[model samples]
Structure formats: C-alpha cells, structure tokens
Target chain A: MRSWWRVLGVVLGVSVLFVGAWAEKLVVIGPWSGAEADPFVAVLDAFKAKTGIDYEYRTMRAEDLSKVLPAQFGAGMAPGDVIFMWGWWIAKFADHMADLSDVIADVPFAYVSPLVVDGRTVGVPYVVFVKPGFWYRKSFFAEHGLKPPTSWPDFISLLKRIKAIPGIEDAAASGDGVGWPLSDTTEHFILAYGGVNTFLGLIDGTIKWESPEVRAVFENYLIPYLDYASEPIEWTSALDLWWEGKYGIYFMGNWITGMVDDPSDLGVFALPGAKAVTGGPDIFFVPKYSKNLEAAKKLAAFLMSKEGQELRAAGGGKLVVRADVSPTAYPPAERALMKALEGFTLVSDMDDTIGGEWQAAFWDQLKLLWVKPGALDDVLRVLDEKFPKG
Target chain B: MRSSPRAEPRGKGEGKSRRGLPLLFWRSSRRREEWVAALGFLAIGLVLIGFFVIWPSIRTLWFSLFDAEGFAGVRNFARLFGDREIVDLVRFLRREPPWGALLHNLVWIVIHLPFTVGLGLILAVVFSKIRSWWVGIARGAIYLGIVTPLIVGGVIIRFLFDKHAGMAPQILGALGAPVPWSAGWTAYPETALLALVIGSIWLWTGFSMVLHSAGLSTIDRELYEAAQIDGASELAQFRYITLPLLRPVTLVVAAMTFLWELKIFDIVYVATMGGPGGASNVLALEMYFSAFRELDPYRASAIATLITLFSLPVGYWFARRRLRR
Candidate 1:
C-alpha cells in the first residue's frame, strides 16, 4: 500500500512537469487588422503546425500601437514576444527591441541595412512593398493609346491626355487627406526628380524643405492637377474608383493591386524619375521584455528562411524581401513588385525616414499646404519647430 | 455579584442621561460604529474614483511638464503655444492647417451644439403631448443613429454624399441644383466640417430629446394647467413655467453637449480624418494624434490637461446643482 501511494505521487508530478514545459506561450503583435490580418494569421497557424511552438498574434493598427505598446511596455507587460512592425517604426521602438543582427545573419545586407539604428540591426525584414506604384487599368491604357511613362514630363503629358479622354471623369486618382496616400506621392516625386541625396537630406537635416528643387517637384509634378484631382477620400474608395474604370492612373503602393477587383486588369510601375525608387520592407523583432525570447527568436529565424518566406507568400500574397527567395510562388502583382525592386536605388518612404511627431505633422500640415500653397514656408517652419536645425 | 456591582463606574441611566458635549468627535461606541458604517459605504466608490479619474488626471498633468526624453520643465506647454502651426491658430490666420482645424471646432460648437439641443427640445415638446407607446418608439428610432458605430456611420455618410457613386449628386441633379455631388461633401475643405456637423446633429439630437424627456417628466402638470387657465398661450406656458423648471436639466444637457462637441473625435476621425487638408480637426482628436501618432506625450498631456481644465467649470456647476437637490 505504501509503494502504490509513492507511484501515484510520481505520476502526478511528471504530468505537471510535462504540461508546464509544453504549454508556455509566445505572443506576437502586428499592425494588420480586419481582412488584411486574415492571411497573416493563417501563416502563423502554418508555423505552429510545422514547429511545436505555440504563439498568439494580436492585430493593432499603427496608431493603436503608438499608444498601446508604450503603455504595455511601461507597465512591464509583454505586449508581444515577437512584434511584427513596419520597417519605419524601427526608430521609434529601437530602444525596446532586441538586437537581431546575429539572429538574421543569413539575410542579405541590403534587406537588413535599412532597419539599422545606432549600428545595430533591430529587426528582420520579412515582407516588401514598392511605393508610388502607378497602377492603371490594362485595357484603359490600351484604349487611350497610353504606354507607361518613362519620364516625369511624359507622365504629366499622359495625365493631361487622360483628362481629355471623353467619359473618363477622373484622369488620375489620389486619396484625400493628410496621410500616406498624399505624402507618399510627394516623397517619391522628391526622390525621382530631386534625386536620392536630396531625398535623404530631408531626414538628415542638410536639405531645406523649402528649397527650389523641392518646390519644383511639387509645382511640376503635383500642383498642376491639385484642384482637378478627386477630393481626398480614403484609399479603399479611391481604389474602388480605379476598379470601376473611372480613373486612368493611381499613384499608390503595389498593395493597391491586392485591393482591386481584377488584379489581371492592372499594370504597375515605379513613378518615372531620377531612377530612385521609394519603398520599404515589413519586419518583425523580439521585444526586450519577451518572456519567451528563445521561442520568439526561433520563430523569427524560421520566418526569414526560404521555406517560411514561401509559406508567408502563399498565406498573405505578400512580396518577399529575401533576394535569395524567388517571387515565382507569389501573385502576379507581388511578382511585378519584386522585379521592380531590382537595379534601383531603394529609398524608404517619406513617412519612414522622418518618423515620430514630424510624420504626423507632415500628414496634417500637407493638407493645409495643399489648400493654401502659399503656406509652404509655414509648414516648413512647423516641421523645423519639432526638429530644429543644428 | 456584590463585587461586580461595586466595579460598575456608571449606571445605564447615567450613560444615557446627559453628555458634557456632543459625542460627534468623541470615540464613543455608537459614534465609532456610525463612522465605520459611513466609510464602509464609501470604500468601493472612493477607490474606483481615485484610481480611474483623479489619479489619471494628476498623472497626465505631471506628464505635461516633461518632454519625451524626460526633460523636466514647462517647455512642452511653452512650445505648444509657440508652435508655428498652433500660433497660426491662435491668431486665427485661417490660411494654414491648425488654424482652420481649430476654427472648424469652434464652428462645430456654434452650429452642432445649438441645433442638437434645439432639435431635441422640439422633438420632446412635440412628443410630450402624445399619449401612445409610438412616442417611445419614435424616440428610439431617432436615437438609432447614435447607437450605430461611428466608423460604420462615417462610411455611410461618405457614401451618401459621394459625388460619383453616391445618391446626393443624383438627388441634387433631379432638383435642378446641378451641384457637384460626385466629389462628395468630404472632398472640399469648405464643406467637410459642414458635412461632419450635419452628421453630428443626426447622431446627437436623440440624446438631447431623451434628456429633455426626463426633464419634462419632472415638471408638475398642474403648473402648465394653471398657466393655461390663466389665458396663457401654448408658447407662453412653455416659456413661463416649463422652461423655468427644466433649466437645471437644460444646463446639464447643454454643458454635456458642448463637451461632446469640443472633444469630437470618432466621427471626424472615421469620416474626414481632419481633412480636405486638416479642415475638420478638433482639440480632442488633435490631442489623441499628438500623444499616439506624434509620440510626444508632453504635448498630448498638455492638450489633455487643457481639455480637463475646460471641463471643470461645467462639472463643478453640475455637481453643485445636484448637491443642492
């Protein structure tokens, strides 16, 4: 009777130990929500099936992350073991993220360099998207005898011709308001016309925002159709306008192709300029306070692997950043984005380079400048107030 | 038994007879129990108020004095007023982003607040005379807009006035107005806040009506009857008796409505996003943007503190009136 009681105790303790070891969780957070989050969730599901690691993904938009992450971090709550974030958010969260250079050593320098802060790679690039991608209806371009423009002047001429096309009410479509839609267009234009140094200089404080070159880019490339273009609506509705065949060309990210009704009917290109392409990659990193750092690192390493990249592409129709990984498995639009990323001086989007408070100001103040063009100096002055000149 | 009787210092009759002073501050058995009972009743409520309200307000005020880097000073507040864009607003220059946004919020208060209260009062007055279940149903129907999520409602409003695919332009065309409905009211800065105001009115008038309904229930019917018997007109009865009696409720509701207007965030956020170039921004939404999007907690806290200070007078007035009651 005494030996039987001892055996029962041993069994109970073993079972508890097994459960404790296997049931530990790894949490992940990202900025994709609603339908955009659906495919990514599936990819995580695939990851769990392949490896016995258990992780939960929480969806947060950019604005929500700005508030929630700080609050969570301050309270010593681990918001995520692994955080899926846009590359631009690296600066804002660098202090809280784990240095991942050695973890992602197999990833190429080009993909890893953009996310470096204070000489440390803070995140691993997992996905990529090209910006200022000019999307037009394939048949619409054919019907109007318009070929993709290779020069800035040609692009403007094409826009004018599109306006002249009878029954085509909107010659070009740009989403309304003070955010990525407008700012991206301005950023790429500055990159394309003003060159890469002029673009980078905006972030480094060497280039004046009110310079003649910057003014010329807006005056020649943007302001001509400012009043003529559609009123500022959100991207979804603007994409809807393109889908309905009302707009000739849409200046947006390649992701717009995913939102369209017929992906096959669209053609895309980086806006014609001085050979500088504005784009960035989506990345993930382990936060400093993660309880399961080992598991998080394991998941990130797998994510940067070729098979994992393929699984993600299959899952989210995402553009992969790894040059080692082929784009053949991705959707035609994503494949096109991959092809476009080659042989170009890749510059991060306008919002990414000058992140934090200035980005918000740029977004809000751009609209004011849009309505009152004479207030450009005032807008510049407002930005200077936040980021003073050395 | 003899020893116990000798040990008794005061007789029961003596204890009850006369107190040298009021026992309020004295730690007598009965007074101590009363104190405990009062504290016991207040314990949970006090804790919740302290944790959720008073504590956060104090923390936010403290946060206002420092920048993101832990630089302790009033520079955030100074920079706030000194901000080129905000200074533009202070001067009412109207040519820039912050200027127009701040002015638009003022316009919202001028237009949305009065109309919401007026429409609510009108609905209450008209419905107050009815003697049917349908009146309650009607009030609920008007309030349906309020219950609809702001994001969903904003989307619907955007579609409603859409210049191209929306019905507004078609209806206008039918009326021979020939207006540009395809571009949407949200498309233009001049019309964006106006569109938001109309949406706010639709959303909030029912809230006012309900508040007015509650006030109407408290007014004595006999006062109105006496006024009518004294040859008062319907308008005269409302003006002299009903209006005077409903003043307390009116003050509370109007103050609340004003607060709502000042802090207008979701509707504009989901609808206009403070655009056609920052034309629809208000103090509250700007505060949120400053805190989260800007990551400048000092400025955000400053804005928050300012908003809280503005709410204090109205809050105090309401509290005083309720206490008087």
Candidate 2:
C-alpha cells in the first residue's frame, strides 16, 4: 500500500506540471485561415523561437469576431489572448480592450489613428491588404491576346471581348456574400467616376448616397458593363470561377495573391484615371480578459516590430504599414504592385471604416443594384434613408 | 375494540390547532409528502426556466427601451415603425418584392403555411389508406427533409434553385420556359423569397405530415364506416368524420407551424442571408443583423420583443385550447 501511494503521488505531480504548461500557451485568434494564415503563423513561429512562449492559432471570420467578442467580453471572458480585429471593431469595443499606447508608442500616431478611439490607443497596426483592382490569370489573358485596359472605354471593350469567349457567360463574375465584394467593385467605379473628394465625402457623410454624381457612376459606367443577371457567388467561389476561366476578371483585394495556388499566374490592375484604392491595416488588440496579458502584449509588440513586419511582408500577399520596413522584403510581383500603388492615393476601406448600419445598408443596396439595375433610384433613396446625411 | 396504533387519534387541543391553519398546511402527512415530492421534482426545471427564458426576456424588454445614447424611452420602438429596413410600405406600394424584412416574413408565412399544412394532410390521409411496403419508403423519403438539419436543408435549397446545377432551373429550361433568373433563383429579388418559401415547404411538410399521421391513427375507423353506411361519399366522409375528429391535431400542427414560421431564422440565414437585396429578409435575420452587424443591441432587443409579441397570441391560444380540452 505504501509503495502504490508513492507511485500515484509521482504520477499526479507530473500530470499537474503538464497541465500548467498547457495553460501557459497563448491562444491567438485572427481572420486568417489556410494560405492567408501561413505568413502570420511564420511570424508567430519566430516569436515562439525567440521568447519560448508557445501559441495556439485559432481561425475566425472577421465578421464573426464582432458578433462573438462582445458577448464574451460581457461575460468577462475572451476567446483568445491576442485577437486580430477590424479597426472599426477595435473602436467599438475599446473599453474592453487593453490600452496598447505603451506598446505602440514608437509607432506614428497618424498611421494608428484608426486603431485609436477617444484619445486611447486600443489596437496595434501590423500589415495592410490593398483592394487594388481586378485579378486575371496571365495565361488566360495571353492566350486570348488580351491586355489590361488603361481607359474606361477600353475596359468595357475588354469585358465585351471576354463575354464573346465560348463557354463564358458573364464578362466579370461579381463576388458576393453579404455583398461586400460587389460593393468593393462598385466603390472602384465611384472613385473612378465620382473622384477622390466624392469618395472621401461619402465615407465622412458629407456627400449623400443619392447625389447625382454617385448616380451617374451607376447609371452610366457600371450598369452597362456589369453582368447584373449573373448570380452572386461567394467571394472564394468567384475566385475559383475566375481561375477556371469561367470569368475573365475578379475584383478583389491583393490578399488573393496568398490564396492562389501560383502567384505568378495572377495579374492585377486598377481602373484607369482612378487615383485612389481602398486599403487598411489588419489591427490586433489584446482583450483585458486575456489570461496571458503580458505574453499577449509581448506577441503584439513583436508583430509591430520592424523585424516581424519584414517577415510578414516577405511572406507576400500583404504590405507592411511600417515605412521603416524595406520594400525589398516583398517578392518581385508584390514589388511591382507596390510600385503601381505609389501613383494612386490610398484610402481606408469605406464600408469597413464606416461600419455599423451604414455598412450593412451599403452592402445591401449594392447587391440590389447588381440584381435590379433599374432600381438605382430606389436603391439610392433607401441608402440615403438608412444612412442620412447630418 | 381498541384503536390500532397507526390510527391513534390526536388530542382535541392539537387537532383544533391544526384545523386553525390553512387546509394545505393541515393536510394529512401523506398528502404533505406528495406535495413535497412534486415541488422537489419541479424545482430544477423552474429554476432553469426562470434563469434562461424569463430573465433574459425581461432584460431584452429593458434593453429595448434604451438606444446608444441611453434611456430613450419608446424611441427604439418608434424607429422600428419608421425604419425602412424594418418596414417599408412605400416600396410595397411601388410593387417591389422586398418591401422590408417584416413584410418579407409575412410573405414567407402567407406562402409557407397553406402548402405545408395542406400537403401534409393530403400525404397523411393518402398514406393511411395505402397498405403496402412502398408506403413506408415513400413516407420515409418525405420525412427525411424534417430529420435533416435546417442548415443543411438551406444549402440544399440553394443548390435546388441554382441555374446551372439545380434541377428546377434545368427542368424549366427543358420545358422551353423563359428562365429570368440566370444567376440562380436565390440571386434575384423577384425569385429569392419565393424560392426560399418553396424550399421551406419541402422542409416543413414532413413535420406536419408526421403529426397528422399520428392523429389519423388515434381516429376511430368506425366513424368513417358510419358515414359510409349513411351514403356519404369519400369527400363528405372526410369532411364529416376525419376533419371533425382531427381538430385537436390540426390545431396543434397549425399553432406549432405558425410559431415556427414566425421564428424562422436558420434556413433563411444559411440560404439567402435575407438578401439579393433584402428580398428574402425576415424579422429574425434582421434582429441578428441589428445586434451583431450593426452593433445595436437596443434595436435587436426591440426586434426580439416584437417577435415575442407576435408569437405570444398563437402560443396562448394553443395552450388555452389544450387546457380546455
């Protein structure tokens, strides 16, 4: 009996130690999965190697974070130690978030403005994904003797050419799901036709959605060219269709480069004379309820560090928001895209920035526009009603 | 004879004191034990209901009274009436398929109710008449829709209406009909709500059928025989005998179906997401969007309150009928 008791004590002691070690591993949640998660995981691996603090990466949808986190916070619990969030969400849930001003003190205040709320820095900026323009397969374009258009008329002609191709139904496949992809495509047209001031005005609520300038963009440019009858495919599925040569072009963010099987086969271009593109940093914040706050802050600090940003930028499909991070850190194709983006002004993603009811209304109205191009008047009226000017 | 020890009488003063208390308190010891046992059995369930259902409901009601700025009495409710996203009578006048989320739900209930209930009754009665092994197979196939998770059913509905891959569109194409929804039925405003409604009918018909099937089993065959002997036709026999006899079952089915229709969320959420421009938007989906997407718990609470209010009458009526019976 005495010998058995001694053995049991030894086993119990070892089990407790293992449990303690398991509990110490930091849990991190972000909106990246599969290919998009690979680069971020590399950054985490580096952190683990340096600090010996292990982490578990949990993938969550960006939209779901807003829905789930609030309830969790209300219950004084958090799903993970470090959470990658939209800037708008960070602003919304600022109270529940830990103050990160000390961590990102050296970073420029202007670059992190979106992550700040009511004079408190609640989030840290890491990397930005640019919604540059449409992506097409280089091989397909080459096979059909097609070149990226540099003019509005030329773009329309290119769409027509693609439509004439056998087995292709629509000129461009409108990616959808809560209608954000279609809204992104529509915003490009608004920027192209309505100009930069109008785009900015719409975001700040200075310009009305029902304004004639915005109406003309829809009436004249998008409706005639866009295949409104084409079914709304999920964004990823739309990517697949575009990849299979079912559609000629897909308007999406530069993140697609990471998602694609081969980055070299992809080519992207913005609207001609459209001197603005939507892009913003993927902000991460530490919840106050995090079990491993000190370690979480350390991981967050590492992510914003020049070394970490360089690793992420080198991974491709993302651009470092930090100017100190060298452009040479990017691949050749990413470097070319970065060079192209230099000519245009970069703006935060409109829907993501002006999120809440206005964002939902914008997505819905754009989906409406896609289906019933004639309902432009109704759609605009409804948009204005949902998001009335001050 | 001497009194048995079990039946020994109490003193007059003690009996008088016990009688002075309420009848419940003065009940026999065995009766008191029965009451204690019943209360003990009910304690956990009552606590759970109080915590989970009643408390949350009260909190939701309180939350609905406030907005972002705080303590805006009736303002949120007023917004519900005025908000075009919640209720748009103007668009309805304009003859649009999507007037608003509330109207879309009404459209769902109006279209979904009849087909599900009617088809279910027809199937149950027809199946009852059949005496073959094939009948079980047929019933099982129809019931499969109910057994399948609604989330899966919603996905099935999406493919069922798909233009290229779905059977409905292909059949329409083969029939030489003009298919207006080239994208898929769920992709267009004109067809999205109707498509979901049709899909719901497929999902819910099995539920009502099983209920009616059980109801049919309890119904005495002698009533039908009496009607037949009196020269009543099959239709008349059904009207006079089966219909009257199945009143309780029909009431239960209709009441449950109505409540289900009012709270329909998962299928719509999974399928159209109340989209193709809010054409298929329902109240529950709107409540979710208001809470999570819009980050307005106040508005969500107001919508939840409205859904509960709408469901209360149906639930009450069903409960009242069941109690009266």
Candidate 3:
C-alpha cells in the first residue's frame, strides 16, 4: 500500500506541473488559412514564447464572419479577443469595437482609413490587399511571346491574343461565385471606364445611374470584360484554375501571393486604364466585448511590431502596415509584389467607399449584370430609384 | 340468467350514489384521472411550443409591418416585390426560377413536391416487395442520403456538379441532350436554380422514401391479395387498393414537403446562396439576406410572414383531413 501511494504521488505531481505550464487560451477569429494564417501562426508563436500566453486562432468564411460577429455582439457573447474583418463590417460593428488609436497611431494613413468610424479608430491594421494585379503563368506568357499591356485597348487585344491560343477558355475570369471577389473587381471596371471622379460621383449622387458615363461602364467595361471570363463559381476554385494554367489570367487581389503554388513562375501586372489600384488592409481589432482584452491588445501590438510584421509579410505573403517597413525588408515574393505596386495610384475599394448597407445590393446587381446582360437598363433604373442622389 | 328487479335496483343505487357524491368535482373518476395524465404529458410540450414557436411567430408578425426605421406600415411588403418588372411578372408566371423570390419558391414547390414524394412512393413500393439478406442493405443504401447531413450532401453535390471536373455535365453530355453547363450549371443564372433543385431532390428523396416506407408498413396486405384473387392486374390492384389507401399518408407527405420548401435554407445557402446573381433566390434566403445583409428586420419578418401565409391553406387542409380520418 505504501509503494502504490508513492507511485500515485509521483504521477499526480507530474500532471500538476504539466497543467501549470499551460496558459489559458486567448481565442482569436478571422477569415484566413493556409499561407494567410501561417504568418499569424509564426507571430502568435513568438507572442506565446515571449509572454507565456497561448491562443487559438480560428478561421471562418467572410460571409459567416459578418453574420456571426453581429449576432455574437447582439447576444453579448465575446467569441474571441481579436477578430479579422473587412472594411464594411467595421461600419456595422463600430459600437462594439474597442478603439485602437493608441496602438495604431504610428501605422500608415492609408491603412488607418478603414478602421476609423465616427472619428474613433476601432481597429489595428494588417495584411494589405491590392485588388488590381492581374496574374498569369510566366511560362504561358513567354511561350506565346505575349507581353503585359500598358493601356485598356492593349489589354483587350492581349485577352484576344490569349484566347486565340489553341485551347484557352478564358484570358481572365473572376472567382465569381458568392460575393467578395467579383464585388472587389467590379469597382475596377468603374475606375477603368469612367475614371476615378466618375466612379466617386455615383457614390455622392453627382453622377446619375442613367448618365452616359455609368451606361458606358455597363456596356463598354463590365460586359466586354466578362466575355473573356468564366461563369460564376467559388473564388477559391477559380484561383485553383489560375494555378493549373486553365485560365491564362485572373485579375484579383495580392492575397493571391499567399495562395500561389510556386512564386517564381507567376507573372503579375497592374490592371490597365484604372486610375488607381483600389484596396486596403484586412484590419484586426480587439472588440470591447473581448474576454481577454489585455491579451488581445498584446497580440495586436505584436502584429504591428517590426519583427512581428516581418514574419507576417514573409510567411503570409502580406503587405506591412507600418510606413517605415519597406518592401526590401520582406522576402522576395512580397518584395516583388511591392515592386509591382510602384507608380500605380492607390485608392480604396468599393467595400470602403460604397459603405455597408448599399454594398449588398450593389454587389448583387453586378452579379445580375454578369448573367442577365440584357437586364442592365432595368437594373440601373432600379438602382437609381432605390438609391437616388439629389 | 336474467337478473331480478331488486338486483337491478341495487346496481342502479350504487351508480346513482357514486354520481351524486361528487366532492372533488370528479363526476367520473377514471375519466378525470385520464384527463390529469393527458394534461401532464402535454404540459412540457405546450411550454416548449409557447416558448419557441408561438412567441417567435408572434414577434415576426409584429415586425413585418415595420421597416428599418420603425413601424412604417406595409411598406416593407410593397418593397419586397417593389423592384419587379412586368416582364419579371410574366417570367414568374411561366414557372421559371429567375424572376422573383415568391416565384422561385413556387418553382421549388412544383419541382420538389413531385420529385421528392413521387420518387419516395415509388422507392417505397419497390422496397416493400423485397425479402432477402439484401433488404436491409438496400434500404440502408436508400436511406444513406437522409443519414448524411445537408451540408455534407451539398458539398458532395457541388463537386459532382463542377463544370470542369463534375460528373453532372459529363453524364448529361453523354446523353446527347447536352446542357450549356461547360461552366457548370450553378455558374449560370437559369441553371443555378436547377442545380439547387437537383441537389435538393438528391438530399430529400430519401427523406420522403423513409416516411413513405413507414406508411407502407401499416397498409393491409390482404387488400392486394383480394384484388389479385378477383383477377385484377397489378396496376389495377395498385390503383384500387394501394393508391386509395395511401391518401392519408400522401397528405402528410405533401404537407410536410410544402412546409419544408417554405422554410428551406441550407441547400440554397450551401449550394449557391441564391446566386450566380440572385437567380435562384428563394424566400428563406431573401429573409436571411434582408435581416443580416440589409439589416432590415422588418422586410425579413415580412418575408417570413409571407411564407407562413403561403403554407396555411395546405396546413389547414392537412389538419382537417387528419382529424376527419
């Protein structure tokens, strides 16, 4: 009996020690995985090593994030200490967001815009996404003696040339299924055809939907471009096709860098005729309702830190938020991406400009336009009546 | 062995005295005991219904008359179909899935009803006749769909229906009646709705089959035998005996199917989200979109109310028939 008690005591002591070494988890939720989330893993691992604090990062779909966060906020349930969010969601959940001005004061002004709601800085910025880069297989372009175009007419000619290749299905097509990728790209059409002021005019009501400029956007830019694109499907699957050399080109975001199977073989060019490349960061914020507010703040602060941002940009193929952190500091992949972004004017995406309420209706209309090309007049008429500007 | 007149009076006197001595308001002790037991059984269920169903439905009804701002009357309902064009009305009337939420739901009803219940009834008939070691295995195979969750089934369907890699287009192409599904059916407007319908039928035909197989068990076998002995053909026997006998079961299936269609969410949600452009958009998806995306609970509530109103007539008929039978 004495011997058995001694063995049991030894086992219990080891168990207690093991349990004592583990910290309580600080849960963070976001829409990222694979290459995207891998960077955060490295950053978080460093945080854990430094502070002896642990975290579980959960990935969710953007659509579900929109639904889940609001419901969680409404129910007074803090699902996590930190959340990754899109621009429009910041508008919807601004009240529940903890102001991150103290943390993000030194971040670049461009990255700061999405997080500011009603003059309150509600989020810390990370993972800058640019929406105008068109990617193609370098070998495919080289074999065909093709070159990237400098203008819109040249771009169309290039698409036609790519199409003339024996079995090419599309020169470019959006991963057009649910909402985000297509909606992100649609604003580019407005920029490409009507110019930046014309695009902004529609938002402010100076330009009517019935105006010739908006009509030209539908007839000239959106429809003509979609002719070379594939039918609507999930964006991820579409990205897979781009990787497989099925589609010769895909005009989407820089996040595609994180998704590429091989970095060296990829060729990217800025979208032609757009006034600027329009997109911004996937902002990370600690919510006011967070159960682990201090830990969340620590995580956000670490993400913005030079060492943390470097690991994130290198591992995640992301752009840095800090102005001082140059592309040269990043790994070759992101460094190349930053080099590609030079000389292009940068503007905010429609997600930022259009705001939240009208965003859905607008995106859905774009989808409708892609399918029912004949429904353009009717759709615009409805959009005008529904969202009339003076 | 007739009882004497005094014997009768004694029995009558005991009964009369028992009835006359109702101290605790129990005229009949056995019936009162039965009533108490029945009430006890219903108490939990009633409380659940009151808490879960009744309260939510009442709130939905109240919310329907309002808009995002406040109680703006039936303006939300007007806006629900407010954007519809005359051509759209014609398109919806023609039973197409592209035009309107209400019309798409109607198409879902038309497609889902016959495909689910009819296929189920046919499968049930085929299943009922078999008696072998393979019986359980075959039945299990048929019920495999019902066993799989809707989300899983939807994902599988999406893969099988992929434009480049899916089996659907390949099979359809082989049939020589090729659909323009080179991009997959769900990638296009008209066909996205059809894809969802096909996927739905795949998921729920088994559900209908299970209900029908259970219904098939209670049917009297002798009726078929009697008709057969009288020189009736198998087809004639089914018509006279099985079809007429299965009316009640059919009503139950129809009512359940209609209700399910009225509130159907997962298939469309997981499969297409009423896209490639809101082409396959149904009332349930619209309600959810209106609530979350538009943040207009009034419009969402109105759509919910519309679904309920649409279901009431069929539900009422089912209840009435069930009570009568």
Interface Cα RMSD in Å, per prediction? 2.9, 1.6, 2.3
> Over the stretch B38-86, how does candidate 1's per-residue lDDT look in tens digits?
9999999999999999999899999988886896687776776665334
Clash count for each candidate, listed in order shown:
6, 0, 0
TM-score of each model, in listed order: 0.86, 0.90, 0.89
Report the TM-score measured on chain A for model 2. 0.93
Tens digit of lDDT per residue, candidate 3, span B159-188?
Answer: 767777788877876777444564477766
lDDT of candidate 2 over B26-95, digit per residue (tens) = 5567687988999899999999999999999999999999997889898888989897767889878887
Residues A95-153, candidate 1: write the lDDT tens digits.
88788777778775344354778878787777776674677888888877899888866
Worst 10 residues of 1 chain A by lDDT: A106-115
TM-score of 3: 0.89
Best by TM-score: 2
Off by over 4 Å in 2: A1-22, A106-114, A227-229, A388-390, B1-25, B28-33, B66-75, B131-137, B221-240
lDDT of 2 by residue, A1-390 (tens): 999999999999999998888777999998888888999999999999999999999998777787788889999999999998877778878999988888887764333353677777788778887889988889999999999998988988898899899978687888877788887888888888888899889888888878888888888888886652255777777788778888888898888888888888988889877989888778888999988899988998898888888899889988877778777999776887888778788887888888777777788777777877888887888777777345
Ranked by TM-score, the better of candidates 1 and 3 is 3
Worst 10 residues of 2 chain A by lDDT: A107-116
In model 1, the Cα lDDT at residue A178 comes to 40
Model 2 alpha-carbon miss at residue A323, Å: 2.8
